[model samples]
Every structure is written in C-alpha cells, then in structure tokens.
Target: MDTSDILKKVRRIEIKTRGLTNHVFAGEYHSAFKGRGMSFSEVREYQFGDDVRAIDWNVTARFNHPFIKVFEEERELTVMLLVDVSESSSFGTQKQRKRDLITELCAVLAFSAINNNDKVGVVFFSDGLEKYIPPKKGKSHILFIIRELLSYKPKKKGTNITETLRFFNNAAKKRSIVFVLSDFLSDSYQDALNIAAKRHDVVGMHVYDPRDKELPAVGLIQVKDAETGLQQWIDTNDKQVRDYYNQQFSQHAQYCRNAFLKSGAELISIRTDEDYVKALQTFFLNRT
Candidate 1:
C-alpha cells in the first residue's frame, strides 16, 4: 500500500478501535486481566471491620493510634499479540477478509491495553518468526502496531504454530498476557502451547470463516490450498465428499479446543462475518 493509504487506514482503525476501548472494553479488560501482585500504598486509621492482621504496629506507635496497612494492585502489565500471517488468513468470503478482521481485533486489543496503562507488543508469524515489536507503553507505539498489522506481508506462506510458540517462549522472559490469533489450521503445536502456557497467560483467538466448516452443493469445483499451493477438484454435490470435508474441519477445530484445554489456556472462536465485540466481552467475563 502507498504511504497515504497506509496512514489513512491506520487513522481509521485508531478512531474506531480507540472509541471502543474507551467506552466498552476498558473496564472489562481491566477486570479480566489482573496485575502481577499487590504493592504497599499507605497506612490509614483502622476501621471497625479492618483486618486485625493488617495493623501496622510501627505506624500505630508513631501516631499513638491504631492504623492498618493498605495495599493496591500493581496495574502495570505486558500484553503480547501473537498474530498469524499465514496464507489461509487471506481467504474469506464474508464482510471482510480474515486478515482484516484480525487487524481490527488487534487494534482493539492494543488500544485497550494502552488504555489500561499496560505495555503492548506484537509477534507476527508465518511458519517462522516474521517480526517482533518489543513491548512499550504509549499511544504512538500502539498506533505503530496497528499500522503494521494493517499492512504486513509475510515472507512465508505456510503456518508452523510450534515455531511461533517457541519463539514467544524464548523472547518473553517475564510473564505476560499473550494472545495468539490464528485460524488454527496447522498442526503439532500442542506441546509448545502447553510449555508456553506454563510461563505465560496465553489465550488463543481462533479466527475462522463459516465456509471453511462446510461446502455448498455447487457440483464439481476446483480448489487450491493457500498454504501448500496445491490444487484439486472435488465434487461438492457428493454427500460423501461434503461429509468428509465437514468432518475434517470439525476435527481440526476439536484439536484446537483440546490443545487449549490440555494446556490450561483460554480459547475463543470469532467468525469473520460476526461481531467480535460480544465474543471478546464473553471471553473476558469468563476469565474474570
């Protein structure tokens, strides 16, 4: 895309997503993801129902009165967005492409993170680690991330989720809230996911199109694999072929769900044509 076009797109997304972050997602996001731990704030006079164990003896002695220690949640956090830039993300027969939806979702999340005064980062992946934007806190940094998400082009066309998870594990030393957004069309990442979840708070956002789950009865049609660049013809009119296609899709989805469950991670499915706000809200509420 041209410079002007890129700026325009970034500005447009910033406007829409920033508004949503302020008006809708801010509270939910804060409630969903908690801080690392509590920190000492200050001591105040003890109340009737105050915890007796929290009494600050030193402060009470100095003030000649009963006082209690107060602590507040340390709200600073690091949020990492692990986005898949694989070829399959380019296929969508809905209101927007899967890639577009992913971009919007990332923008929303970035803005929400910034609104909560958290550091935000991104890992763009396709068969390998494509790019890594280090975590930072600021509106400009969030806008830069949104711009890249809108215009990024992956060097590879395939998806290797294991490699991506491994990279995330190695790169992020501190525990972070990681969001892995992908179509879940790849394989052999269950072990890596489990390992990453042990070190980080991982959440998988599975972006998919309805068409991928089933085939229409449109007779014989030629289809191409986006990642492998392979082509074949299938008779969608045949019940067996349609059933097999649906079964395969179901199996893939089930595998993804099982992986998340076994890893003790969270997962949410968002369709390209559906409203993601509600899905995100539900996920946050469930987590909280």
Candidate 2:
C-alpha cells in the first residue's frame, strides 16, 4: 500500500481502538494491572484488620506498638506487545487477516496503557527479530506504533518464538506486562516461555483463523505453506485426511495450553472473525 493509504489505515485503527479504550477498557486495564509494582511509602500503626505479614518489626519494637509497612502502587508501568509477523498472518478466510486483527488488538492495548499513564512498546518478529520500539508514553508514540504495525513488513517468513522471547527477556531488564500475539504454530518455545514468565508478566494472545482449526470438505484442493512456499495437494473429502489435519491443530493447541500453564502465564485465543474487544474485556476482567 502507498503512504497515504497506510496513513488512512492507521488513523482508522486509532479512532476505533482509542474509543474502545476510552469507553470500555480504560478502567478495566487499570484495575487489572495497576497494583502489581508497589513501593514502600511509610510505616504506620497497625490497624485491626491489617495483615500481620506486613508488620514492620523494626518500627514496632522502637515504638512499643504494632506497626505495619505501607506500600503504594508504582504509577509507572511498561507494557510490551510482542507481535508475530510471520507469513501465516497473511492468510485468513474471514473478513480480516490475522495481521489485521493483530494490528487492531495492539492499537487497543496501546491506547489503554497510555490512558492509564503507562508506557507501551512493541516487538515485531518472524523467525528472527524484526523491529523493536522502545517503551514510551503518549498518543504520538502509539500512533507511530500503529503506523509500523500496518506498514512494516518482515524480512523473514518462518516463526521462532524462542528467538523472540529470548531477545525480549535479555533486552528488557525491568519486569513488564507482555502480550505475545501469535497463532502458536511454533513448537519449540516452551522453555523460553517458562523463562520469560518467571521474569515478566506474560500473556499469550493466540490469533488464529477458523480454517486453522478445521479443514472444509471441499473434495480436493491444493494448499501452499505461506512460510516455506511449499505446495501440496490434499483430498479434503476423505474423512481420515480431515481428521488428521484437525489432530495436528489440536496437538499444537494442547502444547500451547500446557506451556502457558506450566509457566504460570495466561493464554487467550481469538479467531479472525471473532469479536476481539469482548475477548479482551473478558481477559481484563479475569485479571481484575
């Protein structure tokens, strides 16, 4: 697309997603993630309902009274959007492609963070790291990220979740709220995800298409692998063939679930045609 077209697309997404944040997600986002990073503010006399675990023994002994440490939520937070820009994102049988949905999702999240006075960044990746936008707060930064999401093309086509996770963990030293947007087609990232989860608050947003889950019985058809550029013919009418295809998707899904569970992270799935706003709202509510 041309520059003007890209700008228009960016503006459209901004209007839509920003509105969602303002009306629906603003409060939810804050309530869900705000109180995570707390800092010691002061020591005060313990209240009747105070938790004994928070007692400040040093202060209590000096004052000859029960005292508790008070902590305030750190206002500044950094949210990272780890997006998958692999070849498969281009394929969607619905009204929108996975890339398109991913762009909108990122836009909504960015606006929500900035609205809550949090800094947001983005990482675009394929088999290798594509680009990194450092964490910054403001509408301008979010607009710039939206522009890149709609226009930036990846140099590679395959996906390596491990590579991206490792790079992100090493680069971002501070603990962050990370949302990884992908279809979960890769199979070798469980170890890397575990490491990331231990350090950061990780959530895997699995964006997929209906076709990814099931094969339509269209008699016979030829399919091409978007990443490898390989073509193969398949008899979709054959029940066994369709079942096998579905089994593969199921296996990938099961692995994705197990990986996130083991890492103590969160995972949510979205289809290209699904209402992503609702899905995100549900997730934020669960977090709260």
Candidate 3:
C-alpha cells in the first residue's frame, strides 16, 4: 500500500478502536491489569475511614492536627503487542483476513493502553522477530504502530514463537503487560512462555479462521501450508480424512490452552468471523 492508503487505514482503525477504548475497554482494561504499586500522593487531614497506619507523625506534629499520607496506585505501565506476521495470518475466508483482525485487535489494545497513561509497543514476528517498536506514549506513536501493522512485510514466512519470546525477554527491561496475538500455529514455545511469564504479565490472544478447524465437504481439494509452502491434495469426501484433520486442529488448540495454563498466563481465542469485540470484552471482564 502507498503512504496515502496507509494513512487512511490507520485513521480508520484509530477512529474505531479509540471509540471502543473510551466506551467499553477503558475501565475494563484498567481493572484487568493492575498497577505496579502504591505511591505517596500527598498529606491530608485524617478522615474517619482513613487507615491509622498512614498517619504522618511529622506532619501531624507541625500542624497539631492528625494527618495521613495519601497514596494512589502507580497506574503507568508498558504494554507489548507480540503479533504474528507469518504467512498463515494472511488467511481468512470470512469478513476479514486473520491479519486484518489482528491489526484491529492491536489497535484497540493500543488505544486502551494509551488512555490509561501506559506506554505501548509492538513486536512483529514470524520465524523470528521482524520488527520491534520501542514502548512510548502518545497518539502519534499509536498511529505509527497501526500503519506498521497494516503494511509490514515479514522477511520470513514461517512461525517461531520460541525465538520471538526469547527476544522479548531480553528486550523488555521492565515488567510489562504482553498480548501475544497469533493463531498458535507453531509449537515448542511453552518453555519460553513460562520464563517470560515469570517476569512480565503474559496473555495469549489466539486468532484463527474457521477453515483452520474444519474442512468443507467438497469431495477433493488442494491445500497449501502458508508457513512451509507445502502443497498437498486432500479428499474431504473421505470421513477419515476429515476426522483426522479435525483431530489435528483440536490437538493444536488443546496444546495452546495447556501451555498458557501451565505458564500461569491467560488465553483468549477469537475467530475471524466471530464477534471479536465481545470476545475481548469478556476476556477483560474475566481478568477483572
């Protein structure tokens, strides 16, 4: 896409996602993710319900009145969007491609983070890291991120979550809220996820197409693996073939669920044709 087209798309996404953030996600996001710790705000006269432990003896003595140190949650946070830009994410037989859905999801999260005064960044990855946008605050940074998501072309077409997670562990110096959005088409990343979750808050945003789970009954068809560039013929007419294909998809889904659970992280699955907004809202509410 050209610069003009990219800017238009970014503007569209910003308008939609920012509205969602303001109306639906702003409060939910804040409740879902907590601040690091409490910080002292100021000193004020003691109130009836104020905690006695917060009493400021020095200030009380000078004023000859009982005073308490007021504190507030340190609400600033860094948010990382670990997005899959592999070839597989380009597929969808519905309203939008998986890539498009991922873009919108990232946009919504970015807006939500910014609204909460949090810094937002993104890591576009395929078999390895494709691009890293350092965490920063501001509307312009978010617009740039949306533009990248809409136009980024990965160097590698494969998926390798392990490498991506390892890179994230080293790159993010401070703890962050990480949303890893992918179809979970790759495996062997459980160890890396576990390690990362130990330091930063991790949540897996599993995005997939309906075709990824089942095959249509069209007798026979040719299919290709987007990541490996492997082509093959399949007989959808054969019940065995359909069953096997479904089993494989189920196994992969199970593996993903188990991995996130084992790592003590959260996972939210959204299909390309499904109500992603509802899925996201439910996830945020559940997190709360």
TM-score to true structure, per model: 0.98, 0.89, 0.97
Give the winner by TM-score: 1 or 2.
Answer: 1
- Candidate 3's error at 87, in angstroms? 0.4
Candidate 3 lDDT tens digits, 11-56: 8999899999999786999999999999999999999999999999
Q: Give the clashing pairs for model 1.
A: none
lDDT of 2 by residue, 1-288 (tens): 999999999889988999999998969998888645689999999999999999999989998999999998887789999999999998899889999999999999999999988999999999989999999999999999999998898999999999999999999988999999999899979899999999999999999999998999998899999999999999999999999989999999999999999999999999999999899999999989
lDDT of 1 by residue, 95-167 (tens): 9888999999999998898888999999999989999999999999998998888788899999999999998
Number of backbone-clashing residue pairs for each candidate, in the order shown: 0, 0, 0
Segments in model 3 whose C-alpha atoms lie over 4 Å from true places: none
* Shift in Å, residue 123, candidate 2: 1.1
lDDT of 1 at 239: 95
Of 2 and 3, the candidate ahead on lDDT is: 3
User: What residue runs in model 2 are displaced by over 4 Å at the alpha carbon?
Assistant: 39-71
lDDT of 2 at 217: 94
